[model samples]
Target: MTSSLSWRLAFCFTLWLSQPLSLQAQETLADWRDVPVAQLEQGAQNGVADAQYALGLRLEKGRGLLQNFALAATWFTRAADQGHAAAQHRLGQYYFDGIGVETNAQAALNWLRKAAQAGDATYLYDLARVLETQPEGKPLAADLYQQAADLGHQEAAVSLAVLYQNGTGVAQDFARALQLYEGPAAAGQARAQNNLGLLYVRGNGVQQDYVRAAALFQAAADQGLALAMGNLATMYENGFGVPLDEALAVELHQLAARKNSAKTGNLHPGWVFDTRLAPPDSSAEALERLRQGVTRGDPLAGFLLGWHHLQKTETSQEEFRQAARLLRSSAEAGYPPAMANLGLMYFEGRALPQDYVLGYMWLVLAASAGQPEAPELAVVLSARMTQSQLVEAQELAVIKGGDQLANR
Candidate 1:
């Protein structure tokens, strides 16, 4: 369980295990769905494969029956011994994850191999995921992933892209990786979005575009992907494409850390490595770098330092004025979060004179730039403004290249 591999495989393994049994046995299960439990048990005892599988499913899921994993495993084994592919798949999963039986990798492999031989794409994908955890199983796993992908399994396609991206079980092929990731990413798959962002960051298959990378990371982060949030936070900390904002960066880090802590469980047996994404650096050295960036008049540095100052509980009026100026500078350069915070400051008359029209205008701009919290705040402000003020705000927002919030 200590082999070097991406921790992501554990997720894949768990996902495959939880997928509903495929429809290959749908007609048979339908026939047995309403059968009495006693009758089903008799049929299973009478060596009926479908009855055995159906009873196993009932016992395993507690559908109108008391849950019983040991009994479910016994019935699944009986059906699997009769060459029932679904039963074999379930039995294999039980062995692999030790659901009812003691964990046995070799037995799990043998049963899964038999199920996969039935040519179901899902079975092939599950087998591929299991094989992916083994040291010497990578080449075969790659082939299985390819086969499953060809059969239109999107998960397998993403796994195949990872193999191609890392050159683990296949020749290094950035183009192929990009191709595999594109469809899923375009369809708004979070993992594909994050991985594709990494590709853009590395300039692997396309020209390096930190702006595109940051945008992609933001997209995935909006979907609550902790890894993407961490990546985006790193970009902010370093001023990669978005303006640097150390306070915002720290906030994102805390948010991501909380999510990761909540979601992480005991490591799956298949998770053989500790290759989780690393957290971003926010050390003294990074502070010096930000200072240097500010000296060079980097808008990113100004935003970071300014936001940090604004968040302090005991900031002097002079510090507030400096923060407002820096935030205004960053907002004018099209930084969304800066626009958002600056708008809040103006609306609340904190750092600058109260200006409702200007505040609403900035919020509109921020919303148009995909700042998630801006639109609602803009709406809230609109409710308190006169019609003339609302119209003036819309006009100002449009002048700043933002969509009118009137129709919102």
Candidate 2:
């Protein structure tokens, strides 16, 4: 049976075992009662691999049984001894995760290597993950990763590609990384597709192909990969992959922005959105979306709404107030762009009282988050402030806390 089916059966067995003794015997125990625990124990004792694996799972998870990690390990050992691929994989995970036993990375590696050698793709990828983070001077890690990648493990391919690209455990080779990513990306791995798209856009490994890059981005975006969505939106807006279609570009950006908002909530960071596409047909619609995003605690939407207002011929005090609140919320949540915007507001005395110290601090935080312009802005702002104020701002900037940006 498939592992999933086995898990389902195990779950059903657990539910059945929870009833009164008579009900358990009649409704559940009757079918399997003939297969006594003693019989299972005997079978496992006699080197029956399937019985050993089943009993191991039962003991490990306490399904229709008492949780006994020691028994689980013993059963796993028996099954693994009989060369059961799935059992070997489970044993590896148990060792690696230290579930029911002391953590043993080397033991995990050995079991996973056995499974990988048996053509288990999942085990191959798992093995690669372990090797990738091994301490420096371990020469075999990259080779093992490459072996797994050669076996058609998509994640392994990606990991190998990254190692090649960054010269981690391998010599730098952008061309090799690009080559490795192409097969998996073409086979519909979203991560591979996104990374390949980025490489294409940046012309790192191949000639820049905006059209191909957009197509790859679109494939990943269709799978709800937000980074791909944002990249594809940019291509549409800039007429890179397809003809410049402003309306379509805005639609894609809106979709990406909405997904970004939902996924990250108040932790939204300012990303490069291609607005070169057609302007919003209805500012009211944009405003509504922004308001919805803000209600959902999406800082990017709030910042965008603020920018929308500032670009208009007429500015409203209400807009500034809303922008200030949202920006402050985002800044507090560790979004550098929001912090930068808040700094600007303070510097100009537009929304709140002039507070150069606060402005400098926020700008410094923004700079720390990789905003290139923030440091320069901070410097200019600090020029008009006292030395003590600048020192305080510097201190505040270094106070690291929560996640400051969404994981890419």
Candidate 3:
């Protein structure tokens, strides 16, 4: 069973166990009684789309029968063929998740597009999620999100707001983002509530209202949004809109930390999966993929590999040297993170002598390329440079001294 299924079953089991001992079996049996398999099967055979979809659900969930994903997928396909929007969505989701069908992102996108065109808000949002991971698909995804949001899909509103907030495939319009978030936030969308709170804190697209921010954070935190928990904790610590309770802040921070991962809106080159492949599942597999990417002359993969090696806890001297070499290759290919990290390592004398001039030059190039951390590093490193050193660094940064530094 999938982890989601396992979690659901565990929750149901706990709920049943908490009830009166005499009623446990009775209630459990009753839950599946309403779904009569025989009649559903007969109706499905008669080509009734609704009946086929319902039967598919029952089979998928093992309601009054054995769980059979293969049969479930067949029934969903039949219903989907008959223009059942929900069935199309479910079939696509199954394909995407590799539940009953092979994990085929292309097929999933095809089915989801069909469902979205059928005027279903839910499927529209689902299609947008997959498209968001595609190269050159974000703009189309944004359009789908807008459509779904117009139909009052709260989650779609939140997703659209995130694109606007980040300028991903759209102009960065925090005011429009704030406007998009307000409806979903009011509708109890946790991510939207959290993002709206962020705008309030930053005074972006809205007046800085700490109290409003706190309230929104609290609302999202109540729904288990870990980021919002952290935000609320900050408010408590700073006494912005809450009592200054360091202990409470610590507790909330711990809760936030325990969440492990979240859906942050930033997209990266690794997410540009237009080939309909699943992500690698193991470290070796990931490394092999990166190696292949590097073979294809992808600078992003080289940069990632360099960063990965640098982050190893027990990395050896040779490993650090390899890391620098890899970063150098990536930086030469114009990878900004590679340039920034390479510059930092050079400045700190890691696997190389402290070359502040070269470091400053690399950082300047990285900053120009819009690497997020490079500007701050450049400011600090440039402060230590003499006027002549700064001039030399600036001159070297813009010059195409391609093989000169590599030879040295």
Candidate 4:
């Protein structure tokens, strides 16, 4: 089962309760509640580390008991004294997060080190995160991350790989990153799989292996990793990984476009291939295709139609309105491109009254969704508007109802 913070704490408490030798074997929640708080205190006094830890958690969470941070800290200290790995980790987190404890980096590190030494992968990962943020030299952070990665911490592996790839905390070694990603990726880590695929696709750190790259991307895409889906779609369209299959390419692109739109609530612009891939009568065919897709509830199709309208030299008011409606719908659906496009329309007062606030908001959303061109577009739009207007646009962008408006 996936463990939430509460559940993890509960598990630690349960472990503590089970540690005392004198405690009855068949203890239940009822038994725990029936036991006088003083008797529980006596169990801790008897050097029952587990009891101490459980009593501490009960105090910390006020679970069937009173909330007392001081008591909780005392009990955790008792358990920590007994070398309880879970309690140590919990204490570390408490200190690190300043939850029921004074924030102390050194104290957190001390407890985390104990947990890490006891083979707690999660603690190791947390320790790495803390170390990485320290103003100290990069070598220490990289070493800590590597320790966590070696323990099969997936995020740590990905982080370490990225660091190596970019030479952040270590020397730039694309090969090392690729190697690191390979193991975790094979174990079904989505981010690792995505990175490995990218490496293969780019012929970086390894021989060009489009086939492997496509395979890895497919694995990640199957797990609903959106970026992987986009990359895979590109591979299909370009025949990089498999034979050129236009139908398959279109299908994958549609999936990527749909996911991208849904995730960001805006329609992404469709891929515009070079002149070589252009249809003989692309203008008519594209328009017809866009219409068909829109009829079928495809937001991407609507966005593409809007783009066509905007690009038209002899654009009509009707065209602009249609484009606005479609782009708005796609943007509401979290399509970054559509958000950016809609922002552009509002910024320029193309089809509607100029609304800087709404425009800025959409551009911000687009940028947040990792649109590479959003920043440049935002700068250009901001240049044409006043500071107050830009600020207002940002405020309006956060008002979430693009979906409802688009559906209308």
Candidate 5:
């Protein structure tokens, strides 16, 4: 039950909870590929469902028309009334996200159900997710998830495994959970790896294996899953599966905090460095502990101490210098928050020379390391930089080994 509840909560805003519309539609939707807007509009006005759906797509994306969610929803509704499956799905999504109309869970569910009537796995999975939110719908949701899973829907497989693991509307069977998780985990599903790691950590059906658990957590963490990062941080902090590394633990915790907060558009979320079961009594003691770690060359500790100094109400020039120095050191070590902070300092000429190219380079590196705000801020900063500077900054980002993140 704990695992089941945690899975749902952890994925409340993620795990494809509100699946985004696919930009590339099916070939059937491409019928009006080169049709003029007037002709397409005429077909839609003539009650052609495909034309309506196509026009809605154009309006929704503003490809060849002004972006208008309200008009898009209207066209989707017309096509959906004609029993167009894709239109039904799109209309349901619009309702689910309140893109054009007011949010209506029941309407969304109804449209999704209509879409799933054709027995499409994607539609089934989407409907099941909505059903999972309703207390009375758990049994049906489980059935739909199973159907989708059998049809090769990886996300459905992971969700179904959670049900089996927790006996939620199903018999508790760790062996079944393990069976469902193994394929998706091997195929690079971060949630599957994380859940499977939890099972391993608890010895749910197999012998306890901290090493295997840590490896799974690391795999998911590498894909920028906050829960996985937190799990791995614990293992590192306690030396459960790997050598104890306070520096790495602190860095991982900060990374996880930053990732989670980024999802909700928070620019500067606070993080604690206390990895111990019990922590120090006062902020002064915490500062002292950070200082000790910094003296021992812990980059994250240096970054945290620097960040703390910058947060002070009345910081001196010397304090700014110390902060800049510490931030640079940690940034050089590839800590993403430090890189982002140092970039901002450089851009604003705070304790550093104003260099747009260097600042942009750091921002790009931070983005590549999974800092969500870095790319958006980088775009804003680019407006102040020349084209040559932008190109140079991009080149620097690539040369400095920015990782290529996988599409979620």
Candidate 6:
């Protein structure tokens, strides 16, 4: 959403990822068109995967070479054989889409899995996309999607949430689906906000709060999500949240119809618990559910799970690190309790190094977001801080809060 490109679902391993423009990157492939074909061929045959991939890309796109899928596939395979992740991913796409290679599902799966496991988030999402096309691959696709989402792939999270909502691969757990949707939706994901609103109307997971649902629907609707517009209209017509206004409701529905076709580890500070999340029935259940939540990028669950681990004597050092990581993740997701805890932890050096300015800033964020103890704690901590440190922390907190609020 921050860029001009948008990903559209497709059978190919790639889903139209437009590369970011960068000054340095503009000098690489873009300037290498004049490289001699003989030199490129020599490098490719000698097993230089980058050359092979670049040559193949050029061939496939007819940039520096003739447009030849067969030649491109050959070059891609040569690079892929040497464990080039990008080449493997592209070869997998070629196989799936039958651009050059035969339509070999098995081959595509093999290549995609290799790329997904070895490559970054984009590869993971691409592999999941291909897997979703198979007849019995929904579960695997869903799992891969969760993995991608865990790594901050927003599209994958939305896709995985859809699977949970439909009970296609994973079990039909509305609570799970809601947990998956909340982070992305609050972050201004239009489809996520729309779908999450639908759940609220049905009372599937959290308590049915029409006011909350309408607010979410309105948010999504404002972003040009057709279904959200229709949903908001219904809420208006029924007086679910806002005052009943038939004319406004009709206008929204009409508008919707017009576009209906489109689609930290450590220990530390502040508090032990805030009682927003119910304590798990058992530690094991708690661990499992919280993990599931973490996989879905649910910050609340991540913080709760981290807190859970922090309380256990049996937790290992690696587990403590894991707890710290999850807590940091939740804090980044803008959970006030997490920010508060991280602040205190950084200040107190709980299983991590001391960072007073960071601690003060996080506490400031928590206070700004209405955490009960954060104001008092920030005031207390500010006294020990220098004027410059306080100013810097204030600036940092302001920027972070602005970004978080834009999504929330």
lDDT of 1 by residue, 1-408 (tens): 112212122133432223666767575698788898899989999999999999998765544453345678899999999999988988988888766577788899999999999988888988888898888898999999999889888878889999999999899999999999888888888888888888888889988888998998899899998888888888888787889787887999888887665443211111011123232134778757867877786767767767667656788989889878877877787777778778777776766998888887787677666666665565445545654565566566656653323322
- Stretches of candidate 3 above 4 Å error? 1-35, 257-408
How far out, in Å, is residue 374 in model 3? Answer: 51
Better of 2 and 3 by TM-score: 3
User: Candidate 3, residues 1-408: lDDT per residue as tens digits?
Assistant: 111100000000111101221122233234333656787778789988777877776655444433345677899899989887777877887777565667788998888898878666767877898888779999999999999888877878888888898899899999999999998889888888888888888888999998998999999999987778887888887788777787898999888876522222111112111123343333988888988988898877877777677767777888788878878888888776777888877776778787888887787676666665665455445545554565566567647334434643
For residues 257-364, write the lDDT of model 5, one tens digit per residue. Answer: 988766653443232222332432339889899889888988878888888877778888888889899888877777777888888887777788988888877876
Name the 10 consecutive residues with the lowest summed lDDT in model 1: 266-275
**Candidate 2 local lDDT, 1-408, one digit each (tens):** 111100000000111112122221133223333476778778778887777876776554334443345568778888888787766767877777565557798998888788667665556666666665567622466677677677666777877787787787788898998998889998999878888887888788799888888899899999987667777777776777688776876788788777755442222233222243343334678779978987898866766665665555666877777667877887777666677888877776767887877776677667656555665465444446654565555555445322343322
lDDT of 6 by residue, 326-392 (tens): 8789988888788888887777766667787888778777766657777556645554565456556
User: Model 6, stretches more than 4 Å misplaced?
Assistant: 1-47, 59-74, 100-102, 233-408
Pairs clashing in candidate 5? none
Score each candidate by Cα lDDT. Answer: 0.75, 0.65, 0.71, 0.66, 0.77, 0.72
Clashing pairs in 2: 246-278
Model 6 residue 207 lDDT score: 87
In model 3, the Cα lDDT at residue 316 comes to: 87
Q: Write the per-residue lDDT of candidate 4 for residues 101-193, one digit (tens) a residue.
A: 677888988997887676555566666666766676456767777887776677678878877877877889999999888888989988788
- Sort by lDDT, top down from the best: 5, 1, 6, 3, 4, 2
Error of 3 at 386 (Å): 57
Off by over 4 Å in 4: 1-47, 54-78, 81-83, 102-104, 119-121, 148-156, 226-408
List the candidates' TM-scores in order: 0.59, 0.46, 0.54, 0.45, 0.62, 0.50
Best model per lDDT: 5
Candidate ranking (TM-score, best to worst):
5, 1, 3, 6, 2, 4
Question: Least lDDT summed over 10 consecutive residues: which range in candidate 4?
Answer: 5-14
Better of 3 and 6 by lDDT: 6
Model 5 has how many clashing residue pairs? 0
